[model samples]
Target: MKKPEVTEQPGGDPPSRRGRPPEPIGEDVGVAHRTWLEPVRDRLVASGLTLDELVCRSGYSKTRLSELLRGKGYYPGWEITYSVVKALDLPPWPLRRLWTAAAREADKNQGWIENRIRAVQPLGPELPPVAHLGLTQIMRGPYTAYARAFLQSENRAQRAVGETFDILWLTWDEAVAVPDTPRHAWQLLRARVMSRAAQQDGHPDLRQAAFATVAQAGIADLAERKTRIDTMADFFDAIARLPQDQMDVIVLRHLCGVRAEAVPGIVGLTPAMTHTLDHHARGALTGLYLRTGTTVTIDTLE
Candidate 1:
């Protein structure tokens, strides 16, 4: 199929003028997340800094930035997005204009991402250690990488199960199952200390219960046996909205059954502070669900 051509205007026609629709501005860019690059490239070109000069301020390698601008290779992250925009020192409106252009270009080429993914032939499932992947791993970025691989291997229903359980449960189980460095020991010790503190605090039980709620929620979220149509989307959407730090609060306290007092030691917060954060998060979610009135049909965990 012939690619659609877009007309490029220095601020005039778009770059291509094929069957594709004109890309939307920044706010309208869909959730694919790397839409910032198109704008980043435009800013670098407009600033007259030359690639070398832009790299000096942005700290990105001039070569890599150039490759991205020329569409030689794709990037998995948008460090460049914020960097180029920041380096330009452009007025906010100017930066916004560039951002809009980039988003349009990115949306136009979105399929290239899928083609790249399908071409990967990594030795089967050499799934990385969860620690290396980090918090956002489950929701976006690397986590999205995991989900794509997972979907390729299994049906949506099974992938959903793995998303809830294998993706998370297995990681935690595996982490605790084997031994690792002093750092890992320290993390475990921290959790124990916090758990003890929660016991000392009268709210220990509440902390434990709150933790359970989050774990169950995550599990339900992952396995997604939810029979209701679109419940999976809502479940995943809700999880996506949760920050890693807050998700940690859920996993540490609920799934692990650690009391509130013990949470701070493992997670770097005070007992009072942890409690506040947890309550606020739950309250916010409840409000979100109520406002959206998104009902999830749940399947009981086996």
Candidate 2:
């Protein structure tokens, strides 16, 4: 067969001299695509597939794949990304999100003139744009984990995660417009999950579930175990009574496994403020446990 370059020549008019740079939009477009695809491609190649081998399996010409992996102006579409994902024998989960983000950046770069024109329109409030990426799937597990930690019920946690996704759907466009869309979605999900968990503090069903957890974990045979269970119940109740900020910091930092230093980024506070909240939250928990004559350490909470 002839060289693949002949089969996949980039379709566009000749490069016009915009008098700004040789390839004004090329770098941005290339970087967006390369950011995710390059790593995957390198991994596959290291596993033994050559460029020509990948081209044959994926049905994408070598020239096109090479340019895309190099972060050229032409970002791959979903079809191409899907084909590559299959060829690389990788899951479509994150690759699709990366491709969608890259495609959005590429489209924005190519349509700068149109965007500028749209910017001047006296349009009413803009609706959020729809995200084609698998952002929901990406966030589902983390959101569920967060809810489970905060709410302490698997069923409630799943429902809370679903609700978070529903809210994300409504604000999809706004979330996806940011440079780090996943991080934005995470912050939104965290806030929603925590809010829903907080609302459950007075819920009769949650109270019952807490008792159920204690009963399920503690048996009646041992007096010592029963006393520990009682203390555990008081611990959780005390946690529920804490303020929202303290509760959130405690849950995210300890339960969700978020780093202490990184908690501020998710909670939108300075490092010092995050530390202060953590200190206050621990003190509150300590005070609550002390009233019951049980010495509970912050280390035990973690």
Global CA lDDT computed for model 2? 0.57
TM-score of 2: 0.43
Give residue 205's lDDT in candidate 2 (0 to 100): 17
Off by over 4 Å in 1: 1-233, 295-302
Q: 1-302 in candidate 2: lDDT tens per residue?
A: 11112122358645432111111124454443654564564445444566777789989897776665555644455665666666765545445444555566566453642343344323334332345236565456656766786677799787656645544543344456677665566666666555555454462112322454446555667786666666665665666566766766776776567778767656556789779988998998887667767885556545
**CA lDDT of each prediction against the hidden true structure:** 0.42, 0.57
* Alpha-carbon RMSD, each predicted model: 18.0, 17.8
Residue 163, candidate 1: Cα error in Å is 22
Query: Taking the candidates one at a time, how many backbone clashes does each contain?
Result: 26, 2
Best by TM-score: 2
Worst lDDT run of 10 residues, candidate 1, spans: 141-150
